[model samples]
Target: MTDNKRFLLRRRPEGAPVETDFELVSDAIPAPPAGGFVLHNHFASLDPAQRGWMDDAPSYMPPIALDDPVRATTVGQVHASDHPDYAPGDWVMGLNAIEEYSVVVPDGFTAKVDVSAVDSPSRFLSAFGAVGLTAYFGLLEVAKPQPGETVLVSGAAGAVGSVVGQIAKIHGCRTVGIAGGPDKCARLVERYGYDAAVDYRGKSAEQLADAIREVTPDGANIVFENVGGTVFDAELMNLAKHARIVLCGLISEYNSETKHGARNLWQVLAQEATLHGYLISAYVDRFAEGGAQMAKWIASGEVVMDEDIQHGIDNAYPAFMRLFSGANTGKLILALD
Candidate 1:
């Protein structure tokens, strides 16, 4: 490839992102400075969090600057190296950008991958990737659910939420997942092993709350919230005393110009619930441990991993739009091959 292809952020989006907000162009491929290496990306992870990073707002990470290739977590092989610890052809995964290559160092999160450790290199972008690790740490470590506790997961059909429900079940808790459509709801129960599933397609926040209450009669002891706005408000309506609400993502509000604060926050006070915002970066030091456990679960029949892989980096825009469109069935990954 002459230089490299990049999907650049042309402008900050007005609402939900459109293709014009980003432009694809060839640019000079950067050389690794001393101690840095170049990653020839093969697959990059698409996530709702990327939408949040598009804006010029304060967030956990800096906003993606205009004219820059969009930020993404990518898995690739070393193309060239200036670092002693890394070499050509070494497989690595890092929080790189949406481009053909990335220049990075051995930051806390970037590390080499053992391709033989998994069936496919893309597995590093799915089950043993960001979403899986997020679910593992968020549910098991953050929520700290006891046996018999009711665990309700929002966005339950998505990559992370599905894993959260399964892990909760493995730990002996009743799992209820709230997803967008009936098909996703069905998969949550039949495919992902949720105890029950709630469809939030046409339901209002109040109605969704009723649906959740019907399934979790005693109220949920833990609310693993991903979809915010109405879905999150609905979850607030039914909370067990001293419930733990893990704030993972706000998929419903990420694209909106007007961000809506939760209307049912009073339920938190009423139920004495504790809501903690979750960031996967917090547990980066222990990814090896989490990846090992997930590998074991996959080797057994305990955890089923799913990926909706789209071929070609040219399809990045449409592939990413799948998350908001509810078209992709599993973890969305863009293949640059």
Candidate 2:
């Protein structure tokens, strides 16, 4: 039997999670049961949504229970299998626990990964994975942006936000990005094809609104909102008539005890704007359709993919914290091998 190391949830966090909230335990890796497969996980995804999964609250998915391995999306090679569809050497991606090894049934969010289609296995967790799919469906299906419209994206340097900005550009819309720090702001304009960028590092909501207005004189016709709190307020103040807001994530409020409700929601009523909150899982039936389009754009040089990767499972907690602190500029990944 192989010894497997896993991080188990030990306590529910009050605000931001600390490393002490999890307990690392080692045990023999379990063999696959009938029709199940064993995966030797190599990379695990670090996402802002993981914070919500830690809380014992009603959500789209069940909360992670104490003493259970921390839930995560992982890419790995199959080490053993009793399933007909899976083999020992196949590469796969699935929603598995954060551990060196996992035994899972080939159901739910599990699928074989075609490594030949992308640059690396990690891309399955980033641009080519949930991040890309979220951007695709959120912008095209939800927002339905058109040419000459102004598209505003918060957390624009992040995985999903960056992709949202680029996809908006592909649709011939004027793209504006809101991110922390000058470096990330510059990256949004220079690298991600954003027409303008607002640095929200030390700016007030009014300041952010003014900056956004300077770039988009007609106001933003479509808002791809990721970071909430003041960022949402800033964007709220700059919405065009009948603007569409595609709500993807609320990273800023994820770790806060008292979440900041959008103060300018009345703007939605005043401007006749539409706000739509979505879960990527809802579009699972059409994932292949979205993935194909994103892959085409990636190959044609229309979309640029970026990832921030850290090595070792021991650094998982710190790496996860980087998402909240804005230390990571793109999709944050933890490479176990």
Candidate 3:
């Protein structure tokens, strides 16, 4: 057997994760057990959710135990298998880890994929993967948007938020995005078909609220919030009567110790609005339904998704940090070579 490289969690993160928190170690590659397969991982999907799993806290999922590989969604080819459905060299996608190889079973999220459906296999990690699925289900199901309503999205340039804006537009809702910089804000309107884009960088809570109100004079009818903390607080202040707020992610507070959630949740009660906490896992059974429609949207040019792919498992730490640094424009992927 050869060596399988893995980036394991050496210690829990303090504030933001650093290189020292992880250790890259090589272990002997083992054969697949009964009803399981060995996957030769090609791409690992980097996400903000991984940061939440790093902490030893009670959450929607269990924390990543020390000395274990950092959990992530991966795409690869079947290297060896005992399962009847899997064959050597067959392409697959599943919830694995940041490793060159993984032992996989036919979990609900694991399945063989048709590589010809996408331009590249890594596209499965971006546009057609979990983030895209999150946008599809979270908006259409949880937010329950209406035509002609104004939809405001925070973290609008991100993987999930970017897709949310386009889906909102497809549903006939007027889309406005709130991103951090001028460049990202521009893409929200130009690339993602948002009606307007609000630059949230260097703005106070009141200032952000004023900006949002300027675009949406009557206030936003639907707020798809990805960034929590102050951004969420601002959105609360600018909600229209009976607005729907879909809480998909709290990216701003993901790395921080002192997590100050949306401070103005009372706005929900005041405006008689609905604030929904969205979890993509709830819609896992409907992935095929969402994936089919999303593929159609991509084929018709109604929706576009971007990816920033980086090479090598050695560069995992810096690559993961790009999510928080606002450096990556879209889905961040790490390819092991």
Candidate 4:
């Protein structure tokens, strides 16, 4: 058998991920076991959480073992099958490694999408994958938002944050998004139905805080916190009484050499604000319920799944880095042959 190409985690990183930390190596596609199959990978997801996976630290999900193919959620069509449940031509989604093809150890992969309905199978890797599910459960369950409350979402134009703001809107909240630039801010309001949007570039922390507060003078009642660090501190000081802060992603601090802490936590105590950090994987039990709801929203056009897909799998590292640069307007994906 000839070898195939895969990106392996060469070593743990000191901070931000660099291409050198990952080595692209050729490896063989192992033969499927009695109940397994091979999927011709087409699209692989690039998520901010991948950064956390690169570190050798405790997290909701275990770190990717060194020298192993970097972990990712991927969408592909099965070309060979030995499992009764999944046959040839089946489009499935699951936690797959970074490679052109994958050997599915039957019962190892969870079928998330049929692929036929979406037309574009990559949607499964975006809206219906971890990114979409994360937004759904994080906002609906963790925030437990009420109608008419102001909900502010950081990383507002990205995959999870984009969905979070829209879900808040569906619940009848006044949605505000904080993105990085004018284009993203525009998309947040124009494309995703955010009530307002703020660009945080070239602004002081106080100015950013004021900008966010101006839209919800009484203070935000619900905040879908994605980018932490200074932004977290700013949001903490502007919480409404009994506000719910759903800690989703901390992309801003993900690549920092030293962990950053918020000093304004005292505000939470004073305002009686509730801050809850969630890992979507922990809510796998609710995936069916949440996926059903998201699908309904998608069908009804209440929620939109905006994706930013790059052309090749070799671009995975750059796609992953885009999250920190605020280069993606929605879910970032890498397409393979």
How many angstroms is residue 295 displaced in model 2 relative to the true structure, after the best TM-score fit? 1.3
Off by over 4 Å in 4: 1-3, 106-109
Task: TM-score for candidate 4, please give it.
Answer: 0.95
TM-score of each: 0.98, 0.98, 0.98, 0.95
How many pairs of residues in model 4 come into backbone collision?
0
Q: Write the per-residue lDDT of candidate 2 for residues 280-308, one digit (tens) a residue.
A: 88898898889888889889989988999
How many backbone clashes does every candidate have? 0, 0, 0, 0
What is the lDDT of every predicted structure here?
A: 0.92, 0.91, 0.91, 0.83
Write candidate 4's Cα lDDT for 87-175 as tens digits.
77788788888887788775433674766667588888777777899998888878888889999888898889889888888889999
Compute the lDDT for candidate 4: 0.83
What does the lDDT read for residue 98 in candidate 2?
A: 86
lDDT of 3 by residue, 215-238 (tens): 989899889888898888989999
How displaced is residue 127 in candidate 1, in Å? 1.1
lDDT of 3 at 296: 92
lDDT of 1 by residue, 85-174 (tens): 889999999999899988887787787989996778999999999889999999999999899999999989898998999899999999
